[model samples]
Target: MGGRLPMSGMEGFLAGLAHPVIGPDHLLFVLAIGALASTQAGGVWLPVVFVLTGLGGTLLHLAEMNLPLLEIFVSVSLVLAGWLLARRQTPGLAVLLGLGAIAGIFHGYAYAESIIGAESSPLGGYLVGLATIQLGIAVAVCQWCQFLRLSKAGVTEANGSGRSVENLLRYAGFTFFGAGLAFLSGALPSL
Candidate 1:
């Protein structure tokens, strides 16, 4: 299980980044939330809180809590998040935390299921891979939010506005909703 890397360091790292489930849809959702949080609150803490709550939700799924209506919850989250962002409505802290936790359930379930299926390797190595993918998405989202902030503030030569941020958030919500539907349909594997 603790065997040496099968591929070169760079190759392994890139492969980790290329996780199918953690690809575009996941990335966009996280980034959209981050951008919305940054624009509304003018701080990163809220987004960080959101991410951590998501992690907690993932842990819950792994614990086998058997949350009912998981698909409905996820779909609602997407719609609500999109509607809020499009309307430029700043969500309260409680709402943010709740939404983050709910979103985490769906994301976490998928993640835990994937890990269990790929249990051929050392548990530690598998966990590290999971963490790496999650962290990579986080970093990408944060950077994107920062870029949006800079552009909106006119700190950068690039022209960006509130509308652009709103649109991104809306798209993210739609994508998340689609993913939730796919999950519900069993088109995607479940934990």
Candidate 2:
């Protein structure tokens, strides 16, 4: 059920769009990045950095470049992302950008695995699809945070549910942290 490659550009696009959403680790990490970025002034660009690096990672894989312990790196990135969210720390822009770039490569590498045998058209479509969905998710999360006034200053309030948006985001962070640990444990055995 899993070895089949996308047969056309459209198929590749669909597959690429679905890949991040389907992978729990990837989904959580992306969500964390989006939520974290929402707190900063220029946070919207964080996802752009990730998407660009991710594309490069995919191209590197296509060029036969090897990144040892790819899965481990991906899992570790998730752990770091979770930590960033859970702590609610406002990391320096440089530090955050650096982390996003590194993590993007690893995640992108994993993404390329699914399109190894595809032709150029499908590959292009895949890249476009990946970029579109990821950016969409990040922007959506950023907008949501903005709409709810989820800032670092603790000026947010309950959104009709008993908990404030900031509190809910923190909970999301904790969830990502737990999920990352679980993913790391599962990834370690494969090494």
Give the C-alpha miss distance for residue 31 in model 1, angstroms: 2.8
lDDT tens digits, residue span 51-136, model 1:
55655554565567676665455555555555565665657766765666567556555444433323224333544454466655
**TM-score, each model?**
0.60, 0.91
Query: Candidate 1, which ten residues in sequence have the lowest lDDT sum?
Result: 114-123
Clashes of 1: 0
Model 1 residue 124 distance off true place after TM-score fit, in angstroms: 3.6
RMSD of 1: 5.8
User: Cα lDDT of model 1 overall?
Assistant: 0.52
- Report residue 20 deviation for candidate 1 (angstroms): 6.6
| Superposed model 1: Cα runs more than 4 Å off | 1-25, 117-121, 152-191
- lDDT over C-alpha atoms for residue 49 of model 2: 92
- The candidate maximizing TM-score is 2
RMSD in Å for all candidates? 5.8, 2.6
